[model samples]
Target: MTPLFIFLVLLTSQVLGGLNNGASSKNVGGRRQPTGGGGLDENIPVIEIRGEGAPMSSAQIRHLEEMDNGGPLDIKIEKTFVPAKCPQQAKRLDFVTFHYKVFTEDNKKVYQTYGTGPVTIQLGTGMIMPGLDKGLKGMCAEELRKVRVPYRMSRKSKSKVWKNIPNDENWLIFNIEMVEIKPYTPEIQFKFLDLNEDEQLTNKEVQDFQKKMKKEFGKTWKNEDIDNVTAAGYYIKYFDVNGDGIVTEVEWLKIMDRDEKLINDKKTKEKGRKRDPGIGWILDFDNDGIVSYKENDEAADRFDAGPTLLPMESKDEL
Candidate 1:
């Protein structure tokens, strides 16, 4: 071939190869196209919901009036046992017994108690203040919730123990733990309530559930009524991402296993597990496995009332 012709042919082949490589690169880079449908809002967590305020019980209204007689007070969170989601079962007060120490903003010790066993308050009954009852509404067994009730909901209680709290209407901190939840028999109808895996439930969901229960069971029924209905209603509460209510026997077992794992983690970290059969020194707050501000050194910082708030000491620090 002529030298000029050979050069042109060689250049043409090189140009074709480069073009092919460029097309391949474009194909690889364009693999994932932009999806057009409304995507999950990246800003909000999957489980964020709230509603307008619901009707307060007359008693609650009265109590709140007395508490906020001054105004709303700033509240702080002292401690929390809430998982990502809370109040899983959503039972009224089937049975609750706890020990709590009231602390001032500075964590000063104010009131402490080892009181009331199985304090049974029906759900939606207005038997207890709306805040306390509502706080316990859907909590699962052994779930601990620490919420601040504005003075309006708490200040008028007959229990003088908490009366010392300032009425400037500061938030009333409640270190609540859902100790136990016993559902009625399946024969009556078992409704499954699921509370976990989210930051918090929207107030609207709470109100909607309450309204649905009232409409179905009659307004006279309180928390217990809703609890009973929940036990029977569709699996509205205990839904998975796929929205299945009836957890298969396998699913039930999985749930149990998962809960056991969580409980085990909590026990092992907070209080060392049983060991040595009868010879090991178990981590105990005041020689008791139960942790209370009155017992654990960690509770010290929690009850300190001073100008400067001290950070809570952890087990490692202790």
Candidate 2:
């Protein structure tokens, strides 16, 4: 080919490639695209293979190419343990539990744990190794994978925990099996009940949500009258301390603090998951302690599960 023609063809191809990359399309989880803000939003999930200190660029991919040799961060899915349709996608702040084992280069087992109860951590929160964080970003619950992390990509600065590992190399090969994906925050149900855009919630709004749930689910879904000493009524009684009917931002945050306490509490109170603060606690009618659920106003205990502000059925993080 003539030099002029070859140059023109190469230039045209580069322009087309740029256009294609910038085209409007929503990724199933998230991906890179331009925005008026001119910065990649970290919350938007990316399918790209990632390294410890940076996004997977040409250099990092080359590093992986030399490290694991090929095959996209060495990911291999385990279909037997996964469901027919894995419902959720692990997101940035979603809490997750997974069983994992680390192996050395010669296939020697280095570290392992969480096979029974599973280790729980919030994704993207530095609770787990960065290599696993990057590799497992959009993975599904109950799915499994084998991933490799080279020394360069495994956060070398914090490399003090290698007593059993060889002194020469500091890499990890993980055999990971995801256990569960749990919600870290509420979604559409919260917005739908907001009634006013004041960024807070009220008892009546929750009651309306209950009515909508019944309409959407069925008559048998919830059964109680508005005026009764409903489970939800008691719940609002705890946080809506002033009894003014509306819950402000500060009050709602208090509920989250209580949840964190209930979750992290190590006492014997862990026998059964206390979905609600419980029955008698709410009757403190004096605004003395904990709270309860989103009732169709039923006999409280029968329907009183714990309180979920702007309550909605749990859903996958898609």
Candidate 3:
């Protein structure tokens, strides 16, 4: 061919080659292929259940697995499911009080946390399944989300320690609703301090609380070693002003109230409130003199310690 004609032909071939290359490069490796079905978008996942019978056989779970990008966890959120109201945002290390249910692909309910009071879990902690722990991030109080915990993530659930789950179940589907955010408040601290739930915080209770606190929060004045002057002893020595062995509910509240006052004072530092006396303040619940358990429990809900472990119960409670 002539030079000009040859150049024209070469240019056309190069244009067609570039178009083909663009189409090939549109999807690199690791990207998911479209899921196929009628009335269902190819992009959305649909788990087809092939079987011999009716409901049991033809059942299919809408995977909504767009987020399942080969990651250990996959999350599907339904914002419209909940009421218009949504609570504050949840972040890492924040104690979140939430309810959850687990279901098998057959739509059979396996587990639930509703019967027991809402469960509290610290976000980002490995104590929960890896998929769920990560999925719960950025959620707000009352928001609803679905998380699929794969077998790799479900291994922990199969253990004896996680008695709530069925050992045989391979995959776990979670329906999580953020009930409330459990802020580390004085009442919460008090409830944790009142280990026995007797309303009164004894020396033993204080010791246990301090020990747990030291382990979870930070080291004590003496560090790891158990000293003669223990953390509990210091609290008893400081708060048990009358030298009574038992710290009554009134006394418990007194410490908590002091904390509240101190918090308030710090907020308005320049405005200057009266300096709080350590234990000189008054608290007599029964008028008979000592603080009774009944009196102590009157305000227990605000600070009563929740179960550290998952409560074994059904979802109907919520």
Q: Which candidate is the best by TM-score?
A: 3
My TM-score estimates for the predictions, one after another, are: 0.29, 0.35, 0.38
Please give the RMSD of candidate 1 to the true structure. 29.7
lDDT digits (tens) for residues 1-318 of candidate 3: 112211111223333343344443322123433332232232333333334434421112123232345433344444435546555577665678888888985678987878865666555433455566677777778888887665555544232224576534446778888888765444554554576887776767766654543454322321123342343554454455355667665555565464445445443322211221111111112122233334333323312322122212222321
lDDT of each: 0.38, 0.50, 0.49
Query: Which residue pairs show collisions in model 3?
Result: none
Expressed as tens digits, the lDDT of each residue in 1-318 for candidate 2 is 111211111223343344356655433234444532344433433243333443445455556566676443433333334556877888776777788787876788877775435566556544445566676777688787777776555542222222233323445677878888885563322343465767767666656644543443221222333333365565565556455766665555555455455545433321221222222223322122222233223334533543333322221210
Candidate 3 local lDDT, residue 199: 74
Among these predictions, the greatest lDDT belongs to 2
| Model 1 misplacement above 4 A | 1-79, 82-88, 92-99, 115-118, 159-169, 184-318
TM-score winner, 1 or 3: 3
Candidate 1 residue-wise lDDT, 1-318, digit = tens: 111211111223343343344333312122432333242232332232334445555456546655765754333343456566544475632434444445543555655454533333345433355555556665666666666665555543333233444544344566665555555322111122212323222324434544543443223221132232332222223212123333332333333344335445554333432211010111122333333422233323322321121123222322
Better of 2 and 3 by lDDT: 2
- As a whole number from 0 to 100, the lDDT of residue 69 in candidate 2 is 65
**Which of 1 and 2 is ahead in TM-score?**
2
